[model samples]
Target: MRQEPEGYAWSRFGQPEYTNWLDESMSWKETCYIGDWSFLWQHRFTGPDALKLISDFTVNNFEVFDLYQSKHAVHTNKDGKVIHEGVLTRFGDEDFMVHGRGGFWLAYNLEKGNYDASVTNEDWFMYQVSGPNALALLQKLSGSQDLADARYMRAVTITVAGHEIFALRQGMAGEIGFELQGPSSIGAEIYQAVLEAGRDFGIRKMGGRIAMINHLEASFPTIATDYIPAIFDEDMSGYREYFLSSMPPFAKPAYINGSYDGKDISEYYRSPIELGWAKVVTTKRNDYLGAEALAAEKQSPKRVLRTLEWNGDDVLEVQRSLFEPGEHFAYMEMPRDQRGYMWADRVEVDGELVGVATSRGYSYYFRKMLSLATINVDHADVGTEVEVLWGAPGQRQKAIRAVVCPAPYKEDRSRGQLG
Candidate 1:
């Protein structure tokens, strides 16, 4: 099947860039940005066993899940590999909604499990406004103290554009950001209202091209880009069949490009712990799926997530080969791939394979080519030098020098802590 081209998400609503991507890239940090994410799959689970159903499948401990609070829910297979993960928000005692690809997996389990939960695939428009002035911009529109009172990972309903919407305080840009969500009926209205009201605050409309750069900088490992969903293994054939037949085509048949080519599909699969999401995975609960394995793996994770800064000179040499050499290295797109392909390159230490690098992108703010890599924990310390073998295997390749850094290349300010 033909893969979804790059910029697919952005093109669904508007152009890849309203202003130049370079400027738009800095919006969230310098001023603020408003980006649409209405395409994310959503599912509403309600009934007495709603929390139980979620708790049974996910790694998070809902023992004290507060109303209107959100958790990064990670669902793993029996062997502790992540099948899907998303932001799950508890709206009420028995009502919850989750956003992302995990909805399908949750829905499938709801049908198979002996739970009293009923899930409804709901539609909503999710636009995130984030940055130093993100709250200031929203403050102009809502004029409600509730906006300022909202806590991180918590949702508060406030009126926006004459519509009562749920504003979730969560920042993907690692800044103070609020995700405005409501029925699709008021999507355009609220979207336009935010844009118009944001003019004074210097709100920039983010395009698809630059939207994911924040994800890279913030170290949010995406499903296909950072790691493949754990649904293609032999043990998961049942769910795979269900996923292929029921889920969207783009979510199926995940493709990997660049240097890291492992023989088995499981090689691409990653656990939440490997992705530096250990805090979200609780080992106290043994009832959840993959609890035993996750608990054991959490104690001694073989590989951990880190950032690799590619050598500028060696990276430029690959680009220079295009003009003079008979055989040119693969083209390096600026600011990252727009095609949404998982650029998994191989990371080596002393010419020995130690890790796989994914989500390679260029940060205009940092002016460095960076990628998130899941590598052996022994060599994951900061400033550890490694070589990233760019280009595909069996094809012309370049061993670019790289240095280890923090997974989140940028300082995190998502917790509403502004200086």
Candidate 2:
């Protein structure tokens, strides 16, 4: 059997067993599931200017963030194109841990030698405890009923299974979830303790495939797939070398396969508007890395990321109708279209090309097909009729009708209640 990650358990039993367990536990019953997110890059930034550096680099205003409060941050290029996105948790006045995608971008910033910031990758383990009964399970494990008092995004130092750990009430499952992060040495103990506590709650371990599909329901965008890194010209050469050398072997094969959209890397760059990040970009703040360009783009916003629900029957019929079968439907990547490298500003409307679709997925829970696309502001209004090219040119090409709608088609279910 292949060895799993340091903090993960092998789910080689079978796909159906694992998938069914996750689906049932996460849906109807109040159950908990543990996920190993240790592969995610964790950085510790400490220095008086650390906060300032983060504010200058990301679209979210970090000045108002209080200690122990976590917020989402997005780093954009000078052209307002999205480079990296993650969650920033403030532990102290000058200390915070940035979690999620974009380790390469963080390393590039350190190599630039521009600020007084010091970054240290933490040798940590992340465990996501999610489900309707997560809080009860955690309380039972830690022997502390105060687990419910820990508000969302709030971090508290707690002891679990006789091991000290930091528990953050954050997750991508769109359910009541908490991330338990601590040293690797004690990871197994923590996992076992949680499992023991969750025994009566029907807890199960989830794989990457289960998590990936659930993230789509949460409308989470991953780096390297949903967007590309924004390497400055001066840092490109060094960045490329680092990415090639430092990436895990499992990721290397995919990187070599390039053209995630089956087109080109240039088609992978996207702006904040195209990734459903409009609320995070604040132009009123002082000059930032992408202030000027983003400001101009905001005034005359070309495209906005909106969600679309595919007609289920129509999509299924098309697939079943194929006799000899044809190329499977390609999910949206970057630029939304393959005619050429389409930036946020160049998208048009009417006789013009309005926008580009970025990420698309089928929601099993909602029983609907959904996609996130960036379109011209004129056509961004909800309910606006739009046409999306179904297939590539010179193939079975056709325009599919779609309606403009708010992103996160399942918003209510996502933010309903904390377990």
Candidate 3:
């Protein structure tokens, strides 16, 4: 939603960009950076039908999902387009927690069926303590020593600030990390305790403005930043009407950008395969909502998400344009897209429309202008050059040079050095 004029969690008591994001980004990799993620919406499902309801709609194989374990659950539409995705944490056979926009999708699914599952919206505050020293800082907290040995995607319950918290073995930044989730009643206390414990480890509380640098470097395609939420098709007009009536304008794709003048909103829908979620799509043992469509789509995918390393010289010139007299392009905001549009800019190869670029931002950690693009498979080869249109629609556009780079452009150390 047009969240706020600032649109970040900078309101936190700790320093936001104490010096600058360039330093914070470096600290986040070399040492540690703590980020507040309490604004992320969460859904709790508890009932005899909880597993049934969730499994019936998602493509993840629950056979591998055990208590305290989690998976990056992907839920697709009837057309195999990704409708919902989140870290699905299983507490029991019937109790579950979903943290992300997928919670809204789960709630919508509840209304469509007569399932016996009960869903609760949780207003928990989440903190991401991550980087090389993340484990060291977490080890300082009470009941959190087990985090040192926690496996990827595992959840551990810890008592901090006299409150029970779930420490999820995850991070968007792709480092050794734990996502601390607990009730809001003790949020301040927990924050204080963690801060006190982290004082010796060179921890920096990252500002909201540069929060998304991790997503770009780690290859996480977000909803608004990456693609429009696939919620507006002819088949989804009912859901669209319901969503538009209840949700804010920023949450709905149709109401937001209107970036591309194309009549079909479906063109913006990204499939699980296209979004680099191929490994999570499984059809063994149970049927999901979009089984047939996903099976068909698995045979071939047109576009795949790739990193666009914007040419250094051209990017330097774009930044220099900010002071020039007249004709300038869409301003390149650092760390993330501050303007908040989906940024459905045109991507062309030899003057032919080949793909679309989204999620343009600067990464001081990478020290390069970066963006995520869903390009045609043929043009997605690493090192292939393509042109990214660098202006808003009807503006003086410039074709900035870019090249296809490997997704997760750097090695992810999240799964390393447990214990």
Candidate 4:
């Protein structure tokens, strides 16, 4: 028997559930919720080449990148596969802070390149307050109407709990949201303030158990969850060595499971185009790394991201199999996918593999089981019916029926429409 892979490894914030998973999961949609993401890695790049350093490898155009603006930066390998991605906020003409694994990639290249840029590992607190009433809660805490005029993807200085911090309007829940970032020492203080002020607004503390549910419903394909980083390939062996030796153990050795096993590791990788991030990639500049490959891919992309609604009856039948004797199917974890590993399933049409399904979870708000899938462009259409292969290979696999739906199964209210 194969050893099952573990879920994501991160320090827990308070308890696994402040209330309950079900109620907490629904808070983002019905009311509001705050989740701590301070565990994410951050790096500050400074000097004349800061923007140039990022622009050289990332797909985003920086010709008109405004001050105090944040871009969902994406870095791809020579083959046009995504290596790392995250939000990068510009603080000054030559100063920037990027969150997530993207920083690691940037830092590595900075050391090897001849650029005048330098990077420092930063420590900070990141908390995302999102939902319909998210902005109202922030306004109450800051006691200012300035946030009401804050543009999407722009960072503004706000005083909260007597401490000033940068609030970037970046929503990850398909609703209006803000990410408050500041010194690590004051993270706890501001968190308590937000919690206290949010009581009347029905705010809930989001736990790790159901944290990624918002990402699923909003069509955000995460790094380790949706696709593995592109650094593991043999060509990137040097960087891989540096990554393993320099970073913490939990960040290394990403494992994959489920039925969509591929022949080569590259098969598990994804490009910006395939991941529905084409708008951010610019073909105007041909000098960046992998620009040629990405341009060619842009001309003829193969896969596209989408949502899959698993048949409720079929999902229930898998659960029902536990009591009735025969070979029991793999247990379907409720509300979200297993945290530690990439739980990718095989998506097929009439027995022919067409796509890979991931981030499988149940949404209480919708009362349906949904998963984000990268399907073949030919079969990637709303209302198209497909099948999701559940359980590991040779382990009572069941082909559960599913339907292709909008990439963001929920209406996207993240940008330009704040109330």
Best by TM-score: 4
Q: Residues 1-419, candidate 3, lDDT per residue (tens digit)?
A: 21223342235324446657777777668888778877667799999988888888888887777799989988888888887687889988789999877777777888898899999988888888888888878777775668877889998988887788889898678888888888888888888888888888888787656776778788888776676667767787776676557554344442223123444667778888888888898857337878888777777778888989999898778778888989876677766655456767778898887787777778887788888888899999999999887775667667889999988876788885486
Clash-forming residue pairs, model 4: 7-340, 8-339, 8-340
Look at candidate 3 and tell me the lDDT of residue 176: 88
Candidate 3, backbone clash total: 0
User: For model 3, which pairs clash?
Assistant: none
lDDT (Cα, tens digit) per residue for candidate 1, span 1-419: 12345433444336778899899999988999998888788999999999888989999987789999999999999889999999999888999999987888889899888998899989999999999899888888988778787888999888987889999999899999999998998999999999999999999998878777888899999888888888887878888888779755445545668888778778889999999899999988899889999999999899999989999999999889989849899889888887668878889998899999988888998889999999999999999999999888778999999999997889998885432
Alpha-carbon local distance difference test for all models: 0.87, 0.63, 0.77, 0.87
Assess candidate 1 and give its TM-score to the true structure: 0.96
TM-score for all predictions? 0.96, 0.79, 0.91, 0.97
Stretches of model 4 off by over 4 angstroms after superposition:
1-3, 6-14, 417-419
Please report, as a residue range, the 10-residue window in candidate 3 with the lowest summed lDDT.
1-10
Candidate numbers sorted by lDDT from highest down = 4, 1, 3, 2
Count of backbone clashes, every candidate in sequence: 2, 3, 0, 3
> For model 1, which pairs clash?
6-338, 6-339
Q: How many pairs of residues in model 4 come into backbone collision?
A: 3
Ranking 1 against 2 by TM-score, winner: 1
lDDT for 21 (candidate 4): 89
Model 2 residue-pair collision total: 3
Question: Per-residue CA lDDT of candidate 4, range 202-224, in tens?
Answer: 99999877887888889899876
TM-score pick, better of 2 and 4: 4
> Over the stretch 196-298, how does candidate 2's per-residue lDDT look in tens digits?
8877888887754345445556666555445556653453567667766776543331131111223444455667766767777887884677877877877
